[model samples]
Target chain A: MEFNFPPGLILVLGAIALPFLKGKIQQALIVLLPVMTLVLVWWIPNDYTLVLSFLDYQLSPVNSTPTGRLFASIFCIMTFAGGIYAMGQAKILELTAAYVYAGSAIGVTFCGDLISLFIFWEIMALGSTMVLWAAGSQSAYRASFRYLMIHLLGGVVLMAGIILHVHTTGSTDFTAMQPDNLASILILVGFLVNAGAPPLSAWIADAYPEASPSGMVFLSAFTTKTAVYALLVGFPGATILIYIGLYMVFYGIIYALLENDMRRILAYSIVNQVGFMVCAIGIGTELALNGAAAHAFAHIIYKALLLMSAGSVLMMTGKRKCTDLGGLFQSMPQTAINGIIGALAISSFPFTSGFVTKSLETAAAASQGMVAVWFLLIAASAGVFLHAGIKFPWFVFFQKDSGQRPPDPPGNMRFSMWGFSFLCIAIGLFPGPLYRLLPYPVEYQPYTASHLVTQFQLLLFAGFAFFVMLPLMKRTLTISLDFDWFYRRFLHIFAKEFTVKTSNTHIRIEHAIHQRIERFIKRLYRHHGPHGILARTWPSGGMVLWVAIMLAGILLTSALL
Target chain B: MISDQDKHWFYRSSSLPKLWMIQVFILVIALVPEFVLHHHPHFQENGVLVDATFGFTAWYGFLSCAAMVIAAKILGIFLKRKDSYYDE
Candidate 1:
């Protein structure tokens, strides 16, 4: 089976035409493009491949594995839902960029060669940066620059790795490779950078929230998850990912706990959720990889849903800080309910998408006898409930009334939420369809008595702990430092100081040269002054006597010669 | 100051205690499943099944959550700055 045209190109090409067409046609395409892409996503058979020649190498521009299909399916769905949500409010540039962003993410999923994957990868980075920039705020502009820099760095690293790999092995296939060689290691570093892994994990939280509310809904779905898909496909079973994933999980939880901004909290949790996927990919069993893939699918829905609710709040209330939000449930009942559903889904509460999908990873760990890993993952699950599940809804909706009565968002926004809320529960209640979509055969059940009992106990008690320790979790008008501080703050200060110091030294050097020239001029002035012998006019008699003596001496010398 | 007249029932002083009680009751009910349901520990230690202990998930969840919160607090002291810290 083969496709003459790539499925992702529908949205990419459609996005190009979006800005030109206005009103109904634009709106129709906004929704139509993704749905078309989704149909083509599934229309292609599992064995589909479209290999093309690129210079000396054969490039598989379009390939369909079960994992790629699953990811592409969700990418299309997210784009469709995000398109609907953003249509009423987002600027034309934002909508166009977001569609391209979503399209390229789908592009990455179907790519079977490293070169094509890198092409789609860079397009995603560019498109998302444009989406962020379209927010049109000063901070958004600065954040977009920072975001672009990090992604470009990651792209460079990935390209170098691909070149090296192709040069050495003469293969551009983007398949699982051990991180034993420098090329593979560089590739892993590249993927990890985008996964919001450590030392640079701060980029996700730093830039994501800067986008417009609708823009963020699109922003949340693609970038990191594409990296997760990349890791799952290209570096599965690499043990280093396990350690990196653990770091990201905890880093997200800890930072989110201290974060004051609502969207930033969600931003941090993106890193956290991707952390779980990365860890599962590291585990590398069929079930674990399935867990990673399934979790990515489930995560995109819930995370986008979560960000939508936050976006709606940000839109209606004109506020993004938890310190200024509360008791919004009184007026915005629908938004509140949707948010809680999203919260429940993200927390992996029973009968939600997260419950069925995240459990696969835990089960894999247990099955593999990784007791410590299983324990840590369980603890992190509880932590997820604490920070994202309970804290987000609690602070934003149910805490002390801020006396602000912003109604629910506009109709389209609510409709988008309803659609995703339906998916969160639908996938949970009936995971069989989703399970069958996995690359591996389904051998797991999520609704056993033991699993239900344990999950409920864990989540319920986490909820209890949330209230019991409410003081510690109180919202403050403060932001916690993350690794981004090195760039946004520390490096900023360093660069400024370096510039000032260099300019000062530059001035000092110029002044010294000027003084030396002035001194030489002064010395020359003194020697050549009217009072000096050399500067004074000689008397005519004195000059004539001197001339006569010199002439006499020259005549005597000439005669002697 | 919030007038009692405008307060929603959820936040009204009189309804707060009842809400707390309901939460605690549901939490207790969550624990009851441990007694009725047979346990399947994800892992075990040397013939001793640690997860099989009564209310282990409950305690672990609560403790781990509390620990994370406290840990965040400790770290926040050193790391926390005014929201305008970056803007400056």
Candidate 2:
């Protein structure tokens, strides 16, 4: 049977009914929608394009390719897992927004035209903003506004780029392009903004942490990963992304190290992880693209898993700061174990999902013999273990006891965490299935003896460094500044100053004009008033004399001619 | 009401040393493979080795992490502000 409509629409349409439904029905739909979407994602045959005639153009609203399928598959799985996790505690609004968010992300992957891609891109933005808004805190509300401003700005830029690109190239296909013109550069900037790249990288850490525990799990999965997918497809082999990606990687590490909020730390690491994918996309080889895609898939599962663990703690304990949490393993044993598994996976420990998937990118880099890039990637790998891999679990679940023993999150959340944890190990142990889904043929192995040994040495020693540097790594009640500060503080102050100064200058100018006009009017009154020289009653004789002179002059001129 | 006395075995002061010892043992075990296994260098060119020095990954990992921690600390002096920095 052929399914023509975009599969993501299933979730998008289904989610609309959620707020109206109650109890078992809503719950059932929550689980059922993603499953149906997944089935439909597969049911759509390869290379199938559902085209619609719009004006002078053909739009492929639904296009199926291996890369799109890979991303769509993960989006479906994430929605499913996130649904289960959020089922118990998330408000109806959050659940609804998240589903829409997930669906649109899927829609973006399957887009065959720039216009269709853009439409889905916008919906994803609105959906994610709504999800953040549903957290229902003052911070969440405020942060949602900031998040919206940035995304809308990005969307405008993207739209402008698309218009220019289509006008220049006279084609609307969402295929790869060289960054040789204004339009393509704008598009790349637009994609980078969503990928948590620099100058705006602070958005991930600033906004994602403000979400409700479950809200964050959903937030962690979609926006940036979708951006990665877009970049992988749209701007492959763009070398500039490598430097940008590396900046994000270290930026994530440094900031996460200083972060006090557990969720914020994870939020920063999302930037870090996306940095890896962005870097690999910059590499732009088939293997690098494959690695970027595979890493994104693995990243979503483990990142969600990590956030789930953090979220569980947030929900049960009513605290999010690392300084406020410790020794939670006793009460939340399953959560801690799952959290550790996620940490290990993120660190790319042997026999975990990250190790297998991440190696593909590095292998690509190594093959190219880009020595500096390779070394930096290796260093960043170690940095990942330090900040997210060890620091997250160590401080949150171990460290000094804060005397809070919150029990494991309720059944559904636990179920979701275990499910993802299982996938992390399962994929790590058997990468063949995942590798086959890559856009390119799989020609790499991850478990060679040298590879295994080096990975252990790198991670273990990084772990050792963490212990040695424990004194400096103490959590504090502070936040490190990022580019958001420009808008959050600097632009705010600038706007205030601008308004204040402009209004003051306006008043001064008005007063000066008023005074000048009053003076001019006074001078006019003095000269032209009834008692003044020009207003005197002798005007009749003067008028008669002037008239006679004018008549005489005219007669003389006529006679001379 | 759980008390400090009810601490998990993993966190117990007695077990802390044991955990440390285990960590040290694993670190040793990880290095043992460096001697036993033939190393393949990924960043070599022609005949010159760029990255596969003896215990390179191990030391590099340790030093890089330490550098990051210190760098964060130094940067904290300039960038760190109270959690309520934005609220006001």
Candidate 3:
């Protein structure tokens, strides 16, 4: 269908206007914007494309491929659910920034060229960082600065890659990119950083938990998923991503297991979840790509649901650590049930959303005879259950009571949780509709005896392992060592020590020079005062001798030259 | 006595019955396709059975769980300190 107005753009503008509306009107606008975006997303025709010609390149601002539509649809749904969750909170700025963030993520999906994607990418960085800043704590401010530094660095890499790619290919059209050139590799590095790939993956855990409870819900949805969208569009078949993704999956679980902060654990799991999608994209078959896209779609829903549940507990208890939280399920049943659904879904338990979407990746690996990759992927799946799927719910909801009985979150929060929980189960039960929305045709089925039995054995055994090792899983107050220590502690200490040492050296040098000057002055004073020949001088004789000596020195220098 | 009971079921207790119930529930769900939905497309083909029986899901699941559990256990050996480990 040919459209006159940009529906996505209109929804974004409406979201920007929401916080200004005041009271219930703001809430209405919050819900209305995402629903409106979803409608706009559906209304756009599958084949319809919009392109604008720049100086030497063409930029498509509106593209409606099934892949783009699927991501945009889920992003819109996230904004809607996030809006409902954050409705009664006092931080309007965070609410606005979140919409802008979500909108730009949708913008990234619809973008058909490199420049357009870059523009939306930076906008998401700025908007999400603002949400972090809106958390209204000193630590949040510091963490947001670090967060901004990483994203800006990523943006610089992305921009440089795009410029090089355009210079090389004479085209900026966002299409399936093969890593044959330096430019594409650079672009992939940029995308991998945002996708929470290793080495740089520490940024997510370090910064996200510092955000406001509602702010984190928004933080969880946009940035990494947009990177996944970029990867799907740009470098689908890059072989190296398979190993990189595998590293991230295990890295997330291990560090999360070591973490005490509830939100940090979830933040780590985002990397873990996105790793699966990245691995799927790396596989690059039609089924694998579909699995990646569908998982991203399903992931945003369930992950947000999971974050919202954690956020609710943080909101009620004023605690964000596992050691400080427990037995909340008794009072917050709605939150508890919804959280359990999210946990189950993330674990890939049957009748949950994860079961349908995640299985496709494993199936893809097997189909390709990538035995090692498939093995690692399955192990990561079980690890996912161990760390996030079961650990999160068990520790946060059902562990030893901390004797703090906070009431359930507000009605709006409950409603939002219920809404996302329903979506998680509904999609799991009916995978057909989701499958149809994928970019490719769907033929793979999720339910079968062997599939069930094996998935069961794996997950159940993983649970058994969890309980068996419960003694080792006890929460502690210590922060796990991550790559951030290089910046947060080591470099910081090195800088401090260097400053002190250099300043002390400067003081020593100044003192020595001062003493030398003082000694010289004292000698000069003593000589000139009463004790020296000059002090007792016959003035004419002294002047004559001094003049003769100066002449002699000048004459000697001239002779030497 | 009440405190002991609380510790038994809720905290320190093994509660094998609850664990078994969870297992049974998982097994029933896992076997649903074979017994009840026998006509399902996934089962109509032998790929699913071969893939499952040949250690696709079982191996993947067990190995992943084992890796995580082992890692946690190993880390706990060194990393798990008293609740006040960092306080000093």
Candidate 4:
């Protein structure tokens, strides 16, 4: 089917009039915008390609594939939920920016061609950066700038790839590709950058936690997940993604295991969870792809829930480190319970959202006889329980009492958390509806006795490992080194030292030149001094005598010569 | 010098053995899954017992956690820093 207005534009245009509206009405409009967009998303038919001819090329701006629709649905849902969560506390500008961000992400997801995708992609980056900067802290400001630079770099790489791709093939379709050309490889690199993939995966952990509590709800839902959607649509089955995904998985676990900040731990787990989806995408089987898609959906809910719980803690107590937070369950029982639900959901614990979803990825790997991949995935599964599943809630809400008695946050925050917590369990219990939304046929059972037994053993044992190793896993006031060191410190230091030395050398050279010029002037002044002979004014007689002598001497010298 | 008087029930030292008992009970429950489920070997009939072995995942999970912790400690020797590592 064809369309006149893009579904996501409702939010984009709706946000323009937000400033003119007052408090309660303004909040109503903000929440309504996404709800309207969500209705429009479902109302539109699948593969609703909106084609326009521009510059002799057919550009499809709105091409709603099943995967696109699925992601957009969640994005819209997230925007609605996050809007509700952010209202009353967050500045209207952040709310506006977040809606714009979610709109563009929806635009990118449903976008059919490279040009439109790039446009929406850039918007996502700008919008998210605004959300980060809206946190209004010095570190948050710095983190926002760093976050923007990395995403812009990813954007440029993606743009170059898109241009090359469209130029060579003479097509702008945003669909899957074989990594056979430099264009595709560059494109994959660009997509991987956003997917929180290796060598640069540190950006997610570094910048995401710095966002304001409400800002994080928006931040967590978009950006990386949109990239995950991009990988799903464009680069699925690329074998390299398998390794990149694996690296991100372990990288997140290891870093999170060593993390101290409450939100930062969740941030690290974002990379890790994205790693699971990327790995499933790498496996590239229909079931594996389904696994990736479902996991992303499940992940967004639980991850956002976890962040909300942590954000509530941050909002109420103004502290985020595990070293400073504990026994919040004493007063914040609801927050603790919700956070634990999020934690269990993240761990893919039995009868939670992750259980119904993440198992498909492992099942796909196992069925394929990818022995090593299967083993590593199982290990990562357990590792998830160890670091994120157990550590986040245990440290934040249930560890030794820090005597901080912050009450649960306001109604909006609690409502959203409860909503998400409900969805997490509901999806886990009744995955059939979610399963039906997948692009592929669904026949996988999440509650196979063997699978249940295996997951329970893995998770329970991981929990046991946590308590047993509690002493070693104690929180500290230290930040673990990651690849970000190269940018945040190493490159920063290198640039600082280089400028210092270069300026020093530059000053020395300039000083030396000045000294030489001074000496030359001094010597000339000495020779030509007024008191010296050549410089002296002579009397008439003396001048005539000297002239006669000089003339005679010159004449004799000439004759001799 | 922290007092235990105002601690929550979950935090009380008297509750420690009960918590451990509950954990062991959960471990026992975890063991019961293998007894009923006709477990499938992950790869093949002749394949090694990666997924099929009783509590294989448990041991792997525990060992992996231990290894990661140890590795992180070693890594901390070189990479860990005061939180003041980046202030500006």
Per-prediction DockQ, in order?
Answer: 0.81, 0.73, 0.33, 0.64
lDDT of each residue in B1-88, candidate 2, tens digit only? 5553676777667787898899999899888876767777775554647467788899999999999999999999999999999998
Q: Residues A1-561, candidate 3: write the lDDT tens digits.
A: 456444456555776797668877877788788898889888888867787787767888888788899999888888888888898773988988888888888989888789988998998899999999999998899899999999999999999999999998888888998888889988998998899897899999989999998999889988999999999989888898888888888888988888888889899999999999999899999999999999888889888998999999999889988998887787788888998899889989888889999999888987787867876787888888889888998889888877677898999889999999998999999999999999999998898765666677678768867776788777877677667767776888899999999999999999999999999999998888777767885679889999999999999999999
RMSD of each candidate relative to the true structure: 3.4, 6.6, 7.2, 4.8
| Candidate 3 displacement at residue A133 in angstroms | 0.9
lDDT tens digits by residue: candidate 4, A246-358: 98898888888888998888999999999999998999999999999999999999999999999999999999999988889888988999999999999999899999999
Interface RMSD score of each model:
1.1, 1.1, 5.3, 1.6
lDDT order, best first, reads: 2, 1, 4, 3
lDDT of 1 by residue, A162-274 (tens): 99999999998989999999999999989988999988998998999999999999998999999999999998999988888888889989999999899999999999999
Clashes (backbone N, CA, C under 3 Å), per candidate, total 0, 0, 1, 0
Off by over 4 Å in 1: A515-561, B1-5, B44-48
Evaluated on chain B only, what is the TM-score of candidate 4?
A: 0.78
Superposed model 4: Cα runs more than 4 Å off: A508-561, B1-5
Task: Pick the lDDT winner.
Answer: 2
Scored by CA lDDT, what does every candidate get?
0.92, 0.93, 0.83, 0.89
| lDDT for each residue of candidate 2 in A98-130, tens digit (9 for 90 to 100) | 999999999999999999999999999999999
Clashing pairs in 1: none
Q: Place model 2 in a CAPRI quality band.
A: medium
In candidate 3, clashing pairs total 1
- Ordered by DockQ, highest first, the candidates read 1, 2, 4, 3
Best by DockQ: 1
Give the higher-DockQ candidate: 3 or 4: 4
Q: Which candidate model has the greater DockQ, 2 or 4?
A: 2
- For candidate 2, give the DockQ: 0.73
